[model samples]
Target: MENRPDKTNKNNRTMKEKIRFYIILTLILVTGILIIQTILKPIPQGITGVQTLETGKQQSTQNSITGLGFLQPQDIHQIDTCIGDLSSTGAINPGDTVELKQDIYVGSTDCLNIDIANITLDCKHHKIIGNSSSSANGIVSNKTNDATVKGIIRNCHFYNFTNKTSIYTGKPIVLKEGAKYFLIHNNTFNVTRGITLNKTIDVTIANNTFANYSTLLTLYTDAEIYINGNLTNQTNETTIYNNTFEGIGISTNKPYAIYAIYANDLTIQGNTILTSNQITLDGVHDFYLKENALSRVEIKSQSSNTTAGRIERNTYIDTSTAMHFTSFSPNELSNISIYKHDMVNFSLSTMGSGVEQIKIYNNTFAGPMSIDLGSANNCTIWNNTFYPDEQTQITTGPNSKVRNNRIQNGIFKTITVTGDNTTVENNIFTKITGRGIVVKANNATVRNNTFNNITGIAIIIGDDTWQPPSHPVNVNGTTVYNNTIYLWVNLTTNTTMHSLLTGLPAIPGASTGIMIMPNTNNTNISENNINEQNIYAQTPPNMLKAETRGIFGKGINATYTLENLWIHDNTINTIREGITVENCQTTHIWNNNITKAGKTGIKTENCRGTRVNNNILEGGTYSPNIILWYKTGIEIFKSRAEIIQNNKIDKYHTGVYIYNATNTTSINSTINQTQIGIFSFLSMNNKILNSTITTRHIGINLLKTNHTQVNNSNIRNETGYLNTTGIQLSLSFY
Candidate 1:
């Protein structure tokens, strides 16, 4: 059996070994060829294409892709190639085209399956009519993990995808599972639904028209261009430009024009959109919206990530809101800039607690426009013009700033700041009929503002009446500085009878320039210039006259004794009192120059520890002959612990009338051209020390007073009036 090891078996074994070796060699050669082919093949980058012009000549094209808010266009290589026409539904390969010759009716299946990459489907303006199939679509591109499909859909019309029988997902075109670099241009959609993009990237929908017909009963809640994304594959770099969306024959419950969810980096520019609803961005980031004429825009994000964007050069017409922002968490929507927008019949609002750092500038809001910052923090509004038909209202939240704005015409009612640490500066309010700025917050500052021809009060701090402790009183640390107010009534149009009939005050600045209410502590009013002209040719009969003040402070029914008030360095030319403090404590009025004071320059009633020092008061032809006895320099009525020092008063009936006041001191003061200087009536412990009183009548007149001392003073009748006495005492104890 060991003889030569069976020669036939050996020969068969050798043949088997050779066959195995040849098979292995063939596989190796095939694999080597495939590897070489893969290495030498060109890698496809972004959209590279050649566009044919009207002359039928091809040219290389590099198109710009739109991005998220306020971004410029980015150029990329693009391709636009067309193959022969095919009229049926089938799979399309790379470099293949499906061009429709006539209208095709789709039933239960998709018209074209774009499973492969780099394909074009042109319908040549023919319609793809869907007949009530829930899943039927005109074109479908479905890709998987790590795979991309590039598609172009142009010159097509989609109709009747209403899905009346079942759930309505029967869109015209559906791109899913990471479809990238798609260009959809020159298309028309007339259906209840439009195109849908799921998990797509680098897609642009331009030069298209989307409309709803009369046969459409209700539009779907999804937008015309509905974009959706997930956590892993976010929809990025999508642009909708040069498009037209018309919600024809639809009024109520109108769908959105473009609604994106969980998307990133979007550009919506150069589109004319007319819809009753909104263009919503939900959970989106990095958006640029410019040069678009639309109805409304809403940015709402509930995700943990930040939503930041820019909206500029846009026009919104016939809508209730031009822009609205909403968020769920703290600081979720931030760093949004809005500028250069023209809105008609629109409003801007931030209706979220999580919005911050918003900047709005260089915008024009015409007629019936308002701004409401609801619970948003750190917002800024500047350099805008507001022209309202009836009223203009602006409201802000905490740490907000409003500056350099022109609020003119219409009512111009109020700018309400309802939060702490807010600033309103450099704003111009002209031709207004109501109050200018109302600050209901702590640490608020109103500075460098101009109020011209305002018929009502300029600034109001804190509440006029008493409120509960739950809603605590604000304006504790408020400051009003460097503001100019010019108030006048038009005598040519308004009569004193009309003013009296309308309950208007007889004196100018009757509503006051700056009004301080009760419980307003630590308030500073300085460096303000207020001029009010109450010039009338004739006086109305039986009209009630009231004292109007430039800076007025008062207490209400429940709360009294306003403390720590500092009013200094103010120039007031009004028809009544310059500074008045009633039922207040620790009030300071210094360095104030007051002219044309009809009644009193500085009046303090029921006040304690009030100091009026270094003030110049001049009554310039303001005393009417009927009410000449009502004019005075410093009237301290029912007040105690008052100090009137270093004051210059001239042309008044009485210089310092301390009536029913106690513990008062008038020191180092000068009074000239007055009827009675330092008239103390029914007062106790009053001292007139080291003062000069040069008057036409009595200098120091005391009636029914006790412990009154006039020491180190010069009292003279410089006017040489008849029966003028230097010191006249009647029923007094000294």
Candidate 2:
């Protein structure tokens, strides 16, 4: 039974093999047919870089359709071929049409007539003097309002394009007002100054090569147009993308380039800008562009709602940052937008003035920080990259949100915020100068930052006030809170103002480490680390003030009125002036650690309503441990009313310089250190109650003042000169 089954299987295999052989034979026949047919067809060649007859070929052009295939060679003459004046045929008479059957040559500044280049035919309506060859333009239209010349002389073979003998004199097709619907295409030009036209009526110029143009094609902003498929090079932002750019330079030093001024809704897009100068635009509105390259660009201000202007997805690579803006005339436009761009390698060292708010986001700046914001405002700077060693990293000014950016390790300060109302958060300031953060303005929130191994001073506040105190940029409210600053002490050569106060002089009786800011009736500071190494800063001699000036209503002519300042709950380990307030009025300092402070915790002068309560002021020897120097702090040099209550003042040369006070009170406080705790002098109406005073010298002493009352208190540790009475009062008080 098995042998019979095997025989049947063999028969089945034979039948399958026979079918397979037949199918293979059929496939081979089909393949041969395709191969033979392909071989029989002729291949068309490309004409992109070729020229046909060098001289005139009295031949006829056989019109054929070879387009959309391998770009084929067309019959085009490369040399000049024209004799006798085509004009002498007849004075361009009315209704007379001039037509060339084959390609004609154009000469430099060649004239069709003494006055008019081409004939203004038959004083006619609907007259089109068609061009003969692929090139023909040496014509002009005069006394012609509505006219049309057709065909193209562009992207053609190279001919004598010297001495302005370009498609120069006029357009292979040019139109004037009332001249409607003109079509010009596919022309090549190499001229001193290329094609140009303006104040022309509706026209279309497409697929032309304005190459090696010492000065290329230009359509002054005045002309209304549709421009496409054109290649322009070596010029400013004059190559209008889709719309036409007014033809420029009729041979003048006046910069032979395109001008788009006072033009309404001239759309520009998909064009390349390769220039070192910025495009100058005035009175232009409703413009839009996408995916173009600009060396440097600028946008001026105009009437509000800078409407419908979008430069989206464009790439900018300015080597010199040559493009900038100035408000010679004011522009108050609304809706200006710049989004999704890649900008890199720019030398933006000179954008020096008037910049307005434009929505710029999702941009890449792999260059320097040259986009200065010294005078720009209300902007959104998000998702940008500032590569290391770039030139222009950060410029001046304020009210901007420059967050979520990655600016890598560089030699200088990566970003400097010198303006007001700016929020700098969630940014990585890595490998920067030890100086972590720098400020020259007021009313700012510096929070949640990472100063990665920055060797410079981490945090630097440019208050410029020392003894008394000075203001930041303006008298405005500012806050420095919740930041991790690491001040790295590197470069033994450059010493920093590690713990220094740059506010107004600590005016006796006033405040310190603070400013008299505007818009803020009072200032506020809280929850900060003063000893973080990232706070390693450098002393910029540029920030050095001229010299010293007096406090409020004193030698300073400016009226200083600071009321109700609150500074509380901050961890200040070591800083020059834990807090320095000068020539200010009314303050509150509560619950802060002045431990191991480089200077006094609270320093104020020429101020009033001063409350210094519940603070630990200690450990500052090289500097005054706790110095109330120069007529202020619980003392009235010029102002009055203060309560220095419940504080631990330790390790100070002179605890308090309570002098020139109109009214003062010190209650329930512990003073233990060298010299004295409460030293009063030249003050009035002073009262001390229920305080423990133990010092190396007389505990509570006074000098030259009035109404001094020292009540019952713990006074024991008298280490220095017991002969020095515990309570030394002036004769006036006695």
For TM-score, the strongest prediction is 1
Q: Encode model 1's per-residue lDDT on 68-135: one tens digit a residue.
A: 11111122222222211221222233545545657777767676656656556667788888766457
- What candidate 1 gets wrong by more than 4 Å, as runs, is 1-91, 146-148, 164-167, 213-221, 248-251, 304-306, 410-412, 464-472, 490-511, 533-548, 557-561, 621-626, 704-709
Name the 10 consecutive residues with the lowest summed lDDT in model 1: 68-77
Root-mean-square deviation of Cα positions for candidate 1 versus the true structure, in angstroms: 11.5
Query: TM-score for every candidate vs. truth?
Result: 0.82, 0.57
TM-score of 1: 0.82
What's the CA error at residue 434 for candidate 1, in Å?
Answer: 0.7
Error of 2 at 709 (Å): 2.3
Q: Which prediction has the highest lDDT against the true structure?
A: 1
In model 1, what lDDT does residue 536 have?
A: 24
